[model samples]
Target: MAMAALTAATTTATAAHVHGLCSSSSGFNGRKLSVALPRVCAPATSKRKRAGGVAVAKYGEKSIYFDLEDISNTTGAWDLYGSDTPSPYNPLQSKFFETFAKPFTKRGLLLKFLLLAGGGGLVYAGSNATGDILPIVRGPQQPPVLGPREKL
Candidate 1:
């Protein structure tokens, strides 16, 4: 969906540019324009063809052209591990909370509690430290009234 929108925008901008309706200095109605067009980093090759018969611009292995079909075909995971098996530590899995709580269940209770308490204490201390540096507002002092037996 995003690719389609981008492609449509690029085509529209290219058309406008060709017709002299839009430019970097001035766009429609003499307004300044800042349309970002994709830059072609490499020369065109026959191997880099889109389903719509358009030659896509390439930056290394990636394609600059957008295609909706490509979105559904891939899992969107980077091949960091370079293996067929998925990584053991998947935060999005259903057992994520279980895995995360496994360590806290058996050991390090005191350390974790101390860390949490220390974090809270640091926050409170920071507020108190800043209070001394901030300015204090004072109201006008009233004049002292003299009593029958009192002398200045």
Candidate 2:
């Protein structure tokens, strides 16, 4: 009963097409660089939900998520995702491949591994400090998927 009205809203969802080449560091650690200069927009969405449509996405500093918005005259549903943070189609993350997520593409594998391993060791520890069962957090955060919020 509650889901029908939410479905009435219209739709079209896709990845954004942000412009600007990610310039490389001149030296190993050159002067500071920039991505999309912050333009004013509504405060970015924080908590995720599914009031109208089942939208699931993730956000990054430079638009790596999906965007949904409202049409001026439509009397239907709005379809969107993520923080609408603005990002173009990632060449690295196609349907079949994600070999070079932004971090890796920018910082290489060795550095990323060292950082993660070092951080995790300090945080999680080698031996099980607590005896109770625990779930290992998969990895770097992906957009939270809010939904049927049900169990399988």
Top lDDT prediction, candidate number:
1
| Cα RMSD of predicted structure 2 | 35.8
Stretches of candidate 2 off by over 4 Å are 1-93, 99-102, 108-113, 126-152
lDDT of 1 by residue, 47-84 (tens): 78566776766833565345555753353545664788
Worst 10 residues of 1 by lDDT: 131-140
| Location of the lowest summed lDDT over 10 successive residues in candidate 2 | 9-18
lDDT of 1 at 124: 91
Q: Residues 1-152, candidate 2, lDDT per residue (tens digit)?
A: 55764343211011111223224433346753442433559865886664897665655446444434433223344444246664577754563356445456565776978888999897777474764445454443565566685532
What RMSD does model 1 have? 20.0
- Distance (Å) between predicted and true CA of 114, model 2? 3.1
